[model samples]
Target: MALPLLIDTDPGIDDAIAIWLALAAPELSVRGLTAVHGNGLAGACAENAIRILEAAGRSDVPVHLGAGQPLARKFSRQGWGVHGSDGLGGIGLPPAGRGVDGADAVAFLAETLVQAAPGSIALAPIGPLTNIARLLREHPEARQGIREMVVMGGAARENGGNATPHAEYNFWLDPEAADIVCQSGVPMTLVTIETARSVAATPARIARLAAAGTRVAGHVAALLGAYVHDGRSDALFDPLVIAYLIRPDLFVRIPAQCRVATGEDSRLGALLWREASEGAPHALLQAPDPDVIFDLLAQRLRQLP
Candidate 1:
């Protein structure tokens, strides 16, 4: 049976690639996409999600707009430089023909979880944790329905920060929300910056993708082309979450209890990892074979139309 899945995303340049990867994977049934404020505004993220599904000819999947800002912190102008102003590295695709779902992300999430079989649906949040956090706050009982939540955020250690001296961008954008989810007691697996930075998409890899001769492959190649210029790393951050679900052998899971710093100091959003005990909240991941992951990603992209 295909794994029931729902993705909450920000549609970053890499997010677009991740969505395509999930759509191409035969093992996952992506139920819907909920957009949050991260790589772009929530509205733009929803639009990008629609555009991505359109590109993959998977418009049957619904798209919903999510939280526009963090739970407590003021919104900041970030990610445009990395994901481009319009997201997708400003490689403008035509606007989506369909409209976003009227239901807000938090509501949609709650309804979806409640309606699905208990512990049968997986939630993948590749952006900030605002929507997930809100869902937990508004509908705490929804936890009973979730199978697992695979999150792509946080630096496992203090020195692993990608956005600041002590935080990753997604966690830094909404540390309070991260804190809420960390304590929500839902089974969680964290794919952190430590794992993402271990692998990169070099020009050679990009060439392999572009040579696949599929529309999806060409779109991914173009995104990577604009994303990984000047020797910049194109770590498959968001996609790794999806890949982990499809192929757990690609990584080693370290059971750990994680805490996100919600302080206003330099340590804000810093994830403190500790040894897991009874009833620990989450597990940290470490990738062992980046080449295997890259190969799998290429193989999957080639499967798309």
Candidate 2:
């Protein structure tokens, strides 16, 4: 039985790979893609999601436009070093034949969860938590329908943030949204950059992906090339989020309590977590062996068809 999933993303380069993995892998049933503004504007991110799906020949999946910025924060310009101007590293991938309708994303999200089987839908967010927060706020009852939420944000510690030494881009972009989602108690699996940075995609791994003989693989490899030349060697960030859905056994899960810091200081977006005092597990991340995650990600990318 494939796990039904709804992806909320900002269409970064690694986000493109994540989408491909979701569409290509047999274990996941991707119900839809909801775009948010973080790596780029909502319009660009939504367009990129549709373009990536069509590139993978999976246009049947719907892509919905989401919030243009955080709930309270004014639109900020960030995530350029990684996502670049076009969100996909300025790579000129052609747009889809037609984008999704102009229906409001919050309504789309509420309707989708209401219609799906109870506790059968998984929400995987690879960008800001705006859409997720809105869903929780507007339709609190829909929380019962969620199986789990896999979020790619927050840092496990102060020094682990990718954007700042204290915060990751997704959380820093919208800490209020992260705070709301975390306290919602909707069974979430947080995939932090602390674990993801350890699973860097080496040159050889990128080469292997490019040689996989699939269009999706080739496009992902191209994105990897841009990332590498941009002075980063890891496609491990976003792919690990998708790869976790495909293969969870490869990572060691540590249930620890986590919270995002929303202070207007250098510590904003930090992930605060400690041993559970209430005798309950908190969040699971790639632990014990980070190398195991890199190996698993490479193996899965090689298997792309």
Candidate 3:
């Protein structure tokens, strides 16, 4: 049977790719998509999540709108220069309106985890830690209800930050929330820029699938085209997390200690870790292969309706 999972995201273009991978691959049964304020606003992220799913013709998967801002920081939008105002990289898509019955993301997360058999549900947070943090805060007991939580955030040794010099976007958005999640101690795995940056999306690779004439392939192609920044090819960050679920073999892992800083400017969103530490909470991955992951992603994207 497919593993039941929840995807908490911010719907960046890469997040859109991640959603495609989750829905296309049969290994994961997406219980619901919870939106947080990250690559875009909560309203746009929520709409993007549903739009991506609808584009793939998987509207049955519910989308939940989450927090508008972090716990401590005042809410702000990640400039459209990064993810575009629509979060789909300006890929023109049909209206994504609302989701199905009980589409409230928070409630769906609570109910799904509670109803699931112990250790059967996995939560993948690709955007920020807001919703996941809230889930744990409101349902500390539900930690056991989650079999695992695989998230895309943080930067480790040798890998710097995407949003800042030392911090990654997800954690940087709200270090306090990330801290809450890491300390919670539910089994967690982080896919950071140190690993995801290596997973490049090449023009040739993207063109192969874009020519397939499938709805999802075209959508992905459009996203990739819009993702080009300063003549450099785009990187599929979120899909690296999903790839771990579909094809874990593509990643090289090392168990290391990790923590998110909740301090003021220049320190916020900093993900710290040590390979040799007494009780470092999070695990750090040094390198992840993009070719293998993109190959898997392309194959899966081509499979969508």
Candidate 4:
């Protein structure tokens, strides 16, 4: 049977590609999508989630809006230019045909975990940890029902930060939320920026995907085209989380205790990793072959409508 999944995302350019990959994968059955504010505002993120589902002809999946700002900090749109103002590289997809679910994202998450059998659901959060943190804070009991959480944030090393000198964008957006989730004692796997940056989407790879000639492949190409910078390749950030879920063997993981710094300085949202004797240890990804991962992504995306 396919693994039941709940994807918490911000619908950034890479988030859209990751959503499409998840929908196309036969091993995962996406239960729902929860949108949070990071790459875009909650409303736009929710719409982007629905837009991706519609593109894949999988509108059966529900989209719910989550936290609009960080737990203790004011909101900022500093990264909007990186993902485009609309979060889809300004590709201008039509408005989603369906509306977001009525239930709040936290409620939906708690209810879904409560209703599912123990260890039957996998939660993948590819954005800020606001919703997961809020859910755990409100309903700590829900952690027992989760099988494992695959999170796409954090930087293992101090110098590897993408947002600030010592922070990745997702964790930098909400350090308090990141702290809550990391300390929640839930089984977690962290795919960091170091591992993601190792996998670059080159021009050759984009051309290969476009050559597939499917609408999904075309969309993937466009997103990658906009994402890849001059003389630099786009990092498959969010997609690496999904890729790890599907093939854990493709990566080398280490056991470590992680903590997010919530200070209000340059160190804000910096992820601190260390060895621990007790507590729920997180699997920190080391590295994976970029060619193999891109090939896998290309094959999976071609399967979509």
Candidate 5:
């Protein structure tokens, strides 16, 4: 049986690919998608989630809108440059065919997990931790239902950041929320910006799949094609979350402890992670074969539209 999943996201360009991947995967069942602010504004982020599900013909998956800004910080759109003004690289996919299921993303997250069987559901957060953090604070009871959370976040040390000199956008966008989730003591696996960077969707790779002549792949290629190519900005960061869920063996998991920089500065939203003692609940994940991951992307997305 497929493990049930709930994705907390912001529908960045790569986020669209991740949702497509989750829908295509046979080992997971997506119960819903909740949107937060990161790649774009909250309204656009929620709309993008709806559009993604509709495009993949998975409109049955409900979409919920969360807060438009971080829990303790004033909103800023500095991270919007990479995903473009409208996100999805501004390829202009049609507006969502349906509206969001409700106004509260945190409530949706808490209620869904609480209602599911204990340890039967997995949560994937592909954006800033705003919604997940809110859910954790408001409903600590729901944590018991989550089997394991696979999060896409943090800047790799080598890159410094995709957002700032010392921070990845997701963690940097909301350092307070990331800090809360990190210290929540929940079982979590983190996929870093480096992992996302390693599996880039370069023009060559994207074109090869676009030529397959399917609606889904072509749409994905067009959106990805519009990505701001700052040499390495077109990395498919979010999809790897789905791939990890399907094949954990393809990744190296190291037990670690993390601390987020919540102050406003160059290092704000930055995460400092260090290897931890044995059996730590938190881990950092890295992919060993990006080629195999790309193969999985092509094979699974080809199954859609």
Candidate 6:
């Protein structure tokens, strides 16, 4: 049976790629995409989600708009520059034809979980944890339906974060919400920024992807070209979540206790990792073949529109 999957995202350049990857993968049954506040404004993120689905020709899949900001912090002018004036690297991949399926992502998520079989659905939150936190807060029973969550935030240990010296963008955007989810007691698999940084989008890789000749690869190459110029590290971070799900052999899971620093300043959303004991339930991910992940991306892109 195909794995039931739900994606909660912020529609960054990489988030769009990840969503496309999920839609392209036949092994996953992507129930819906819930938008949140990261990489851009919430409304823009929703639009980006719809636009991303349209690009993939997966309009049948639902797109639910979720929290506009963090649970405790006020959203500011962040993520705009990171993803360009528009979320899709200003590549202008055409607007979506339809509107969002729903406005309440938390409620939709809870409903979807409750209606599905117990421990049947998996969540991939590749954005801020605002929507996930709200769902866990409002409908704790939904936890029974969640099989696992593969989160693409946090800066594991060294290398630092993109938001500040201390925190990554998604967690830094809403550390409180991240903390809530971390403490929500769901089985979590953390794909940290430090681990994802290994899959750098080099110029040679971009050229090879461009030369793939599929429509999906062409758009992907354009998006990468736009986002990865001027010596940017060019890590397409989000797609690794889907790849890990599809190819578990490519990664190693390490048990760890996750603690998100919820400070109000520079230290906000810093991820602290430690040894996993009985108290520690989360698993930290390590990519064994970060370069091969791009090959997986190419293979999957060939399967999509």
- Compose the digit string of candidate 5's lDDT tens values, residues 101-122: 9659999888888988899899
Error of 5 at 9 (Å): 0.9
Q: Provide TM-scores for the models.
A: 0.96, 0.92, 0.93, 0.96, 0.95, 0.96
Question: Which one wins on lDDT?
Answer: 4
What is the lDDT of every predicted structure here? 0.88, 0.79, 0.78, 0.88, 0.85, 0.85
lDDT of 4 by residue, 1-305 (tens): 89999999999888998899899899999999999999888998999999989988998999999999999999988777787767787776777998999999999999999988998999999999999999999998788779999999998886888889899999999999999999988988999998888998888988888876779889888889887853233788999888888888999878888899997778999998886553446878876678898888888887898
Candidate 1: segments with Cα more than 4 A from true spot = 230-232, 277-279
RMSD of every candidate to native, in Å, equals: 1.4, 2.2, 2.2, 1.6, 1.7, 1.5
Taking the tens digit of each residue's C-alpha lDDT, what string does model 1 give over 228-291?
8834457878989999988987788888888899876889989877977756668888986777
Ordered list by lDDT, greatest first: 4, 1, 6, 5, 2, 3
Q: Give the TM-score of candidate 6.
A: 0.96
Error of 2 at 143 (Å): 0.9
Predicted candidate 6: what Cα RMSD to the true structure? 1.5
TM-score of candidate 3 to 2 decimals: 0.93
Instruction: Name the runs in model 2 displaced over 4 angstroms.
Output: 233-235, 277-281, 287-305
Per-residue CA lDDT of model 2 for 1-305, tens digit only, reads: 99998899888888888888877677898988999998888888899899888776778888889999898888888656566767777667886789776667777888889888899888899999999999999998787778878888888865877779989889899999998888887877778887777766667767777667666677777788888777864636776777778788766667767777888888987877775644343565674354565445445555444
CA RMSD (A), model 5 = 1.7
Choose 3 or 4, whichever is better by TM-score.
4
lDDT of 2 at 230: 74
Backbone clashes (count) for model 2: 2
In model 2, state the lDDT of residue 200.
69
